[model samples]
Each structure stands twice: as structure tokens, then as C-alpha cells.
Target: MPSSAAHLLSNHYNETRNEYYRQLDTASRNGGDILPFINYAVQGFVDQIRNQIKHIRTEQLRIVWINYVHSRFKTLSSRKDRRRRDLLLHISEFGLLHKNIIGVMALKIYAGKTVTTLKRDIGYLRSEELIEETLTGYFPNLKALTAFLPVQRRVVE
Candidate 1:
């Protein structure tokens, strides 16, 4: 009924993980257990290896999008712990149109950091004030270009 994207992005992944465990539990009852399989065939098991690869590939994409979406929510929310109480609040706050790809790219452009020396001073390059908290995570608050655009004189016919 309402916007489900936020609920989906946050809850869906966790639900999937839960589902996997449930399957494992069922498999345990059916056979012996998955722990034995994991322990014995740690490296050479093709099925396990394939499953891991599949999980990672699917989960990686979800993480990227979900993180960005949550960042947007955090930026907009007026609370300190701005987490979704349920799907309803989430949908009301971040509508479908607001879930934008361009916004995500803008966040990356503003906050992206290089893998440099951890011991090196971070304050030189990073600004704590400019970062915005979204429901998902922290994002660099990128100023809109329109505010800085030069005004153009309109010629009347």
C-alpha cells in the first residue's frame, strides 16, 4: 500500500539470512547437520564454494543500494537514532521518487575516501560538519549546484 522500498531494503536482507538458517535447521533434521559438512569440507566442497559466491554477489549489490538509501533517510530524519519503526514510517519519509540514483552518486562523489595510511590525520581531508546522517548511514552533504549557478539575462522578444 505505502512505500515498501525502505522496509524491503533494510528488512529483506536480514529476512533472507534468517531464511538460510531456517533451511539449514531443516536440513539438519533431515540429514545429520550442516556443521559437519562445513567443518570437514571447508575448502574443497564445490557446493559450499558455489553457495558462498552466489550469496556474496547477490548481497553486495543489496548492500550498496541499501546503504545509500538509508543514508538519505538519515539525512532527512529529525531524530538522533533515526531508524525505521516499521515499513509505514519509512515509506512516508522516503517516497519512491526520492529513492534516486543520482543522489547516491552525489554522496559518493562528496564523501569517497582513498585507502591511505590509517595512522595519518583524517581531519585534513574529512569534514565532520558536512556529513549528513541518513537512515542507512552517514553521507557527505553535497550542496546543490543550482545555488552556485550564474544567473542568465533573459531577452524579451
Candidate 2:
């Protein structure tokens, strides 16, 4: 269960973000009152979501995605500009680990660029040392380069 404070804060942040989106849309379409403050608030909310997601378990990412509703997730909406770098890092890292577990099967998932985009991202990730493929297709990378990324399972447990 989430702490009471966490629950309340999440609720508050979500509501505030939605309000800002509504305001921004109205201002853009109808004109007037489209304050820069609305944009700033939306950016802050997006950052908070990104920061919080960084702390979440991989398995729980889908849960967070499901529970959180924002313009960010809309099919036609673009990703936030500031998040591009972080997202690239995540996509690269995920691609690498995916290769490790799934072997050549990873080729099918491709990260970007083409139908093989996931494969391309993983290839780049290996070059960056975020992960490495011991063999051409199936094998765990000897070391993971993402030292700061939280590992889902701790050995002590």
C-alpha cells in the first residue's frame, strides 16, 4: 500500500496537471488566459512523473502507466522535450537487457529506426557498455553499465 501522504500527493499532482492541460487547450483554441504559468506547471508535473518512474520497479512500470492518466500518454501527443535524453537511456538499457534474456529473439523487438529498431538500440547499448552481449545471439552481458539504475531484485532478499 502507498503511504497516506504519497497517495494524497499523487492525487493532487494528477488533478493539478489535468487542470493545466484543460486550461492550455482552452487558451490555444479559444484565445486568452493561456498563461505561461500553465506550461510551467505542466512541465513540473511531467518531471515529477519522470523522476518517480525512475524509482519504480520494471514490473510495476505498467501499473504506474495504467494508474496515471495524462496528456503525456495520449496516442497523438508528443513526448516531452526534456525527457528525450532520459528516454533514450532507458530504451537503450532495456534493449540490452532484453538481448541478454531473450537471445537472438531480441532481434524481433527492435528499438528504433526500422522494424529492427529495438535491435539497433540494443546494438548501440552494447557499444555504450550499458550492456554487452557475450555471444552473437543468446547470453547475459558480463556487466551492466547502468550503476545508478535501481536493480529490481536484491540478493539479500
TM-score per model over all chains: 0.22, 0.22
Task: Give me the overall lDDT of model 1.
Answer: 0.39
Candidate with maximal lDDT: 2
lDDT of 1 at 47: 39
- Give candidate 1's TM-score: 0.22
Residue 113 displacement in candidate 1 (angstroms): 41
For all candidates, the clash counts are 8, 6
- The reply for model 2, stretches above 4 Å from the true place, is 1-113, 136-157
- Residue pairs with colliding backbones in model 1 are 70-136, 71-134, 73-135, 74-133, 74-134, 74-135, 75-133, 75-134
lDDT of each: 0.39, 0.44
Candidate 2: residue 18 lDDT (0-100): 77
The local lDDT score (0 to 100) that residue 139 gets in candidate 1 is 38
